[model samples]
Target: MTGHTAFGWRTFLLRWSGEWADSLPHDEARDPDDEAARRARWLGFPPASQERVTAMEERLGRRMPPSYRSFLLVTDGWRHAGGFVWLLAGTADARRHDNESELADMYEEDLDEDAGPEEWREAGIWRRGLQLDVRSDATYVLLDPEDVDEDGEWAVYTWASWRADAPKRYTDFGSFMEAMYREFHSLRAHRTGREPAFVNDTTRELDARVDEARRDALRGDWERALKTLDEAEEYGRPRARGLGDQIRRLLGRTHLVYFPDVVTDPRYAPELLPPLAAEHAAHSYRGDASLTFPLRGADDALVSQVFATLEQVRAGAYRYTAPGPFGEAVDRARELARWGDTDQAWRTLTDALPLWRPLGPDHLVPLGWVADPVLGPLLTVERGRELLSTPRGGHPGEAPAPTPGLDPPGLAWLVDPGPGGGRGPYRFVLVEGVEPEDLPARLGDEDAEGAALDAPRTLREARWHLPRGPRESSSYEDRPVMAVGRAGAGWSFAFDGDPAPFAPRRFVSPAASAAAGTRAVVVWSDLGARRGESFFHLSVARDGTREYAFTCTDGEIRRTGDIPRALDPDRFFAVPGAGAAAERPLLEAVAEHFGVRLPRHALLNGRLHTVTTRSWTRPPRDGETYLVWSMA
Candidate 1:
């Protein structure tokens, strides 16, 4: 069998009045539009028609492709030497070829062996020769050589012949042509009652699901639309080139109703998503999809990944750039601030001037009219100066001394594991100048009434003082301290010197007291309200367990003491001389000297506590208050 017969003869046939070129019919020179000058030509046909030409499945039944039926309407029959029919099955316009050899390359079989009028007619086969045509039209018809007038008529046509056995089922031109082509096989199927197969399976199922998704999306049934698409995805991987675009579009909005949990589950392989993230960054789209479609795992992931990369770029974290700004600063601050020129040390600070200048003490941005949040205090020039000078070479002086209290019973800052130092939950306190013996009494309950700003007189006399400590000690702190008995993140400390803001109820217990020697009397008031009327009190025991006393007074202070001079101002500290009144005596000293007497005292005894030392008590699982004190 000839190559054409082997594949199946489905050819386009075009006819015109002209001498044939070379051996092939349509290769002859001819006027493209001159009705008389054009020669007949053959075009290509759909694969199903090849079955008929080869007669491979005549018994089982086979169908032609719809493309074949569409091609027959314009096919031109071949007129070759010794009745050798040249097969054709494509449009002169649709198929671009400089010669008949190109057109013949598309022809698939020998049809003359079985080409009877009924067989040809029933199958809607036409004999059309391929030819050069000036018509730029994308569509044209197939021609039957018998239907053509030999007198010469100019016409460009589909090369493939058609053997239509049934009437068209569709009216729309495209649909009609497809339906007409479908008839060629449908007839065989009807008579033989068999299924027909074609090579290169088309994804009609996927297309239907995609179309359904589109319709549902149009109807605002986003969930349903996504579900339909999801179902389609399950059928098989989408092979269409458009699948990538569809995935990206859906991803942008998928967060709204799409099963994100499922979509993001690692089980869903990243390869499952379109590779468009790299391409779509530049591809143009006209609608909201252009802006809304996700680039990577939904746009946010893309953005985060990009920013993370930018962070590396900023500090040259990967050693890509000359140690970036922050890196340079850190290195220079260490190297030069040591034994390097003090002037150069100042100059190093000067070098960082640009970055430091813009920041204000708040570490916010500078503004012309208003403060820039980015250049606020603690970040500004003066502040930077203070910070830079405070710990040059990580020490207080030149020659770089080891961190104090950090090594060999060294001195350390109020924060343990100092700046940028430790993995934390870091907790520490600074109580400079306070004697250890006097600590218990000062924390004890003595002069509780004095702890309050006003003595109880009338309902209107109620006034209170807010506790004071480091304002920087917020719930979230870069440097946190583990206090002996303080609640939440608060800390407990004893000062070696006089405490700032002498009204000592701030950090010290109002009723605590101490003696020059002997035992120290300690008492404290912890108050809090939960839900409603669930008043609470926390007391520091000599062993440091916070004992919680509930149902305490809301407006009064309580006091108790064992050491006589525990609360005596003359013992540990003397009352300020009239001239030293500006010193503002500390209230804790008075509270330790005097005894407290109120329901608030009862409230002080009940609370929760976390043990910072072995002497401290175990923390209760559920409690209203806590207290801790050192018996030593």
Candidate 2:
């Protein structure tokens, strides 16, 4: 009751509320019953009388061990000792595993040379063991009478046929039951979002603090919860570190923590495992079993699988992912690895990591493997240093050095910046029959009182100069700082804008129409913020007529003109009552449809030849009042 691993029958199972009504089967839940099945649902039955315990001991030809005998004194039998083992045998029903001839080969077969002295893992283990569970799932619990300790406590072994691991050995039945209690908590947290909050009455202070910390985490007060749980964990409180792990995930702060259970979610395993494996391998090399315990039962089956996966990945034979930046990069990485250029392979993965995005809530996007297929085998151990050594995602890193010689990914960065800071409320144009250098002169035509382009600036510098007026205050109100570049076969003409009353009628239509001039195809996205603002519009013009136009308001796309056959707005923007959250996939689909990509170095990182478009500002079009402020 006092030690961390203490085992108390009702004390632990009391967490389940001791509500026989709730635990009963549906047929019994409503009708009261004394049926054996119903009695079993109590998770503990009535304590065996002294005469019954003595009779069972005599029948078994040996006295029951003290730990198990004491357990029966508290409760004759127990249920759900482990996740799978459902019905634990009481004194009257307990049977011998040695009596089952079908298990002789399995139990009597040769033990591997390195097999531990744990009785449950050796040849003829079952011959000396008393089976303690009946009618179970995949797990079998055995008490080895031959393995009694000085205190007359029977050694317990729990073998889960579902896992490849050997029967896990516990020094005593009490310790084995305690491990089952811990596993139960893990299952609860994974399935139910960790309900009930408090753990128990014994560690009320720590339990209450952990519960309050969990609440804080639920309220997005992650920093507070993390700090509180960190303190609680120092007391070796149950679930304190586990809850902290969940918070660390929410904050993108899982840098230091590592253990067998380090990767909280399977999706994280791909991104996090490489670094973890690197540390594990390092510890293995140094013979420092501190970081990594000797693979006690069956070779840390999880880690062995991870290395096997890494081997497959390095050999270019892992299962392929969906077509995207990450898949392509992985292909290149594997090729490099195959060619014995592991360093370059690592750099390739790191470079593409910026573009990686998690497939869904299941993944910590951009920080996760893009469209990650599995947990193990995403990265090689040698390459983990590049990923872990480089601090990622929390802050806006300095712009990447210029890569002018390389062609950029077009304009896709406007849609998704991976795990980086938000990139949105975008206003940009795609024009056919134009060059990156020509966008300045074309955009200048849209100037109300003859606009002048500002000297080219980097994205960081350019964002600084937006929401300002020219020295001649009347010259411009919203000077657009833009990175003009080539996108695929057309020219990507993008402009920066502070939030606005989305162009009420079509400020960009005129620009699109003028820029169209009976020859070129121009597409303009005059978008609204994902939150608050409701205005959103996309237009495509060609040969002096609007080819397609649509506005996203009221959770639907209202269109004008014949929509292009190649694009589907409904597929992207048609989330009913989804609010602003629906807009993200819409923009992403647009980028995907056009194969629009922009280089990270140019659009996100280092300086590029960026020009401030001649005032994208227009006056109160369609009776819209724009909110304008200035640092100018």
Number of the predicted model whose lDDT against the real structure is largest: 2
For model 2, how does the per-residue alpha-carbon lDDT over 1-632 read when each residue is reduced to its tens digit? 33322156556555432432233344533323235434444567778888889999999999988777877876788766656776788987797887353454775455566667753345555676899878688667888888778988888877766778766889987777767765554454344332344334434666788777755544435557678878666545656765565445324344554522335345445554443444444345544344334222324655565565445443323444434787698778654432223344456766765555544232222333311222122343323323433322332233233222322343444545445455556566666667666666666535422234344344566566544465333322455566565554454555443333354443445345435553233334433345455556677766566777777765666788876554556665555755455555655565676666444433443233455555445655465545543343
Displacement of residue 233 (Cα, Å) in model 2 is 13
lDDT of prediction 1: 0.27
The whole-model lDDT of each prediction reads 0.27, 0.54
Q: Tell me the spans in candidate 2 whose CA falls farther than 4 Å from its real position.
A: 1-41, 99-101, 112-121, 188-632
Worst 10 residues of 1 by lDDT: 368-377
Top TM-score prediction, candidate number: 2
TM-scores for all candidates: the values are 0.17, 0.35
Instruction: Count clashing residue pairs per candidate.
Output: 141, 10
Weakest ten-residue segment in model 2 by summed lDDT: 368-377
Clashing pairs in 2: 357-366, 358-365, 358-366, 400-606, 409-597, 409-598, 409-599, 410-597, 410-598, 411-597
